[model samples]
Target: LAALLAPGNFIVMGAALLLNGFAVAPTLTAGLAAAERSVVEKRKTEVLAWAISALNLGGALPPAITGYIIDTQGVSVAFVIPLVCMSLSVVMILPYLNIWREKVREIPA
Candidate 1:
């Protein structure tokens, strides 16, 4: 899906944004939930606060570089950063694939 953005077309951009919008709520909820669960009872509050702070910092930090890319390179190039980041993120998480599969879904089928 992130790859779809590389073309920088309106249709793909809208589709990507729509799909991302659907993901945002669940992702944010699960991320915070996982942070809350990963710590001892006492640090849960601090962890959540840090999670939120990181979200804010993540939100706040990207535009300068992306804007620079957009200004000098073009919007299409700017979109490539997400594709690269997504690929890197997948690779980074590959070490935990077994853990992910073990608890990926809990709902009974």
Candidate 2:
């Protein structure tokens, strides 16, 4: 976003945003669905609330951090902030995904 936006090309920015939105929709939906699946009946609301809160915070905080980077660094460089964060997130999630898969298998679907 910052990289494309820096060029001041509205058309490319708009297309990128549109495509990015499409890409993110499934990821966000899957996160929520996984949360729903993982929660217990008694704490469903609380768990969902926490999931939503985390989602909101995750969505909100990166922009501020990126914006700060954009101010200090150049826009192209600022995009590295999100790229690194996302890379770290994938690393962090890999273990949990394996655990979730094992648990799901144990459920005897």
Candidate 3:
């Protein structure tokens, strides 16, 4: 944030964070919704527990891996790794978005 507050960088960083939040919110929400929807009625609690565990694991794994990479390879390369990972996630999720939209449409009138 201090780095972001530096003159011209502030505007750019703010815009990036804004865009990131917009993109992340729906993706994260959909992931949670999908997890909920996928559960059997009787086992919803167990499924939710697994879903939360998976979410935490996903959140933790990248940072740990990235931190290790940064320690060994330097900060710049570590930063690029997330860009690549995010790009891949977007590519993979794009198809699923259409599927999700169809499911939404199919909900009873």
Candidate 4:
């Protein structure tokens, strides 16, 4: 948010994006690992394929949508799409968050 809202500071935005880039790999890996671990061995391959498909679709769609929003409503409104998504994801995940936390705790890190 700070990066997005930073007043004419491209450097801050770049740095923020760079930091965010660092998180993407670990987050995706953990998500896929958890997804695989949650299912039976026979179903693991199917689950992984589905996960990859979703990730691919997710990666593909957002930029075009965001670009359209920016073209139509301008830069200010473009942020709303992600903010709403982030908020909605939080709301949807809150109930299951404790369960995930416990699962993470069980991992032999």
Candidate 5:
């Protein structure tokens, strides 16, 4: 991996990390908020199941997709594919930003 980090690759890697961090940070935060908001005081088991299912599903999908892509293509191309996916994820999330904002606003002081 260190050898892969030559000057030319460094720039792209840096940009990819930046973009991924930006995309993931809010998703993680919103996911946490959503799980918290969805929890019911009396039905702890159901809420736990839902949250765990969500977390497990979210964790499972990306690696499988990326793994298939990498197996068919080469590593460099595989690495680039996530950037495209992350960009699309950002676009998909843009419309829901208002929803996230509303959730954030609901947080008690």
Candidate 6:
């Protein structure tokens, strides 16, 4: 998706924006739900607090970084920031995947 953006392609940019919207819309809710599920009952509030803080920070910080990247590099290169961040986020959570799986599986239907 990042690779699809070019300097003057409105169609590609619009498509990317639409797809990006779809991708990001569920992130906060899903992230908080997963965070809540992954923690123990006693620590759930603390974990959720941290998750909220992280979400706030993540929401606030990226535009400035992306703007800087856009100024120095170009819009095409700036698009890669989200992709890189998403990849790194996945890597960061990989160690906890088993815990998350077990916790989620324990929830009754």
- TM-score per prediction, in order, is 0.70, 0.79, 0.64, 0.80, 0.56, 0.71
Model 2 CA deviation exceeding 4 Å by range = 1-6, 106-109
Superposed Cα deviation of residue 58, candidate 6 (Å) = 0.4
Q: Comparing candidate 1 with candidate 5, which one achieves the higher TM-score?
A: 1
* TM-score (C-alpha, index-matched) for candidate 4: 0.80
Model 3 lDDT per residue over 1-109, tens place: 3233564577777887788789987977777777666545687688778878988898989989998999999976865786698799899889888877776666544
lDDT of 1 by residue, 1-109 (tens): 5455365477777887898899999999987876676566899889999999989988887888789889998877875887787799899989987765554443233
Q: lDDT by residue for model 2 over 39-94, one digit each (tens)?
A: 56797788789988998998899889888888888876875776799799899999
Q: Number of clashes in every candidate structure?
A: 0, 0, 0, 0, 0, 0
What 10-residue stretch in candidate 2 is worst by lDDT?
100-109
Find the candidate with the highest TM-score and give its number: 4
Ranking by lDDT: 4, 6, 2, 1, 3, 5
C-alpha positional error of residue 93 in candidate 1 after TM-score superposition, expressed in Å: 3.6
Give the C-alpha lDDT of model 4: 0.86
State the displacement of the C-alpha of residue 20, model 3, in Å, after optimal TM-score superposition.
0.9
The stretch of ten residues in a row with the least summed lDDT in candidate 3 is 1-10
Name the candidate, 2 or 3, with the larger lDDT value: 2
Q: Write the per-residue lDDT of candidate 6 for residues 1-109, one digit (tens) a residue.
A: 5345475778788887889799876977787887787767999999999988987998899999899889999877876787899899899989989987888898765
Instruction: Name the TM-score of candidate 1.
Output: 0.70
Q: Order of all candidates by TM-score, from best down to worst?
A: 4, 2, 6, 1, 3, 5
lDDT value, candidate 6, whole model: 0.82
Q: What residue runs in model 1 are displaced by over 4 Å at the alpha carbon?
A: 1-12, 95-109
lDDT of each: 0.77, 0.78, 0.76, 0.86, 0.73, 0.82
Candidate 6, 102: how far from true, in Å?
1.3
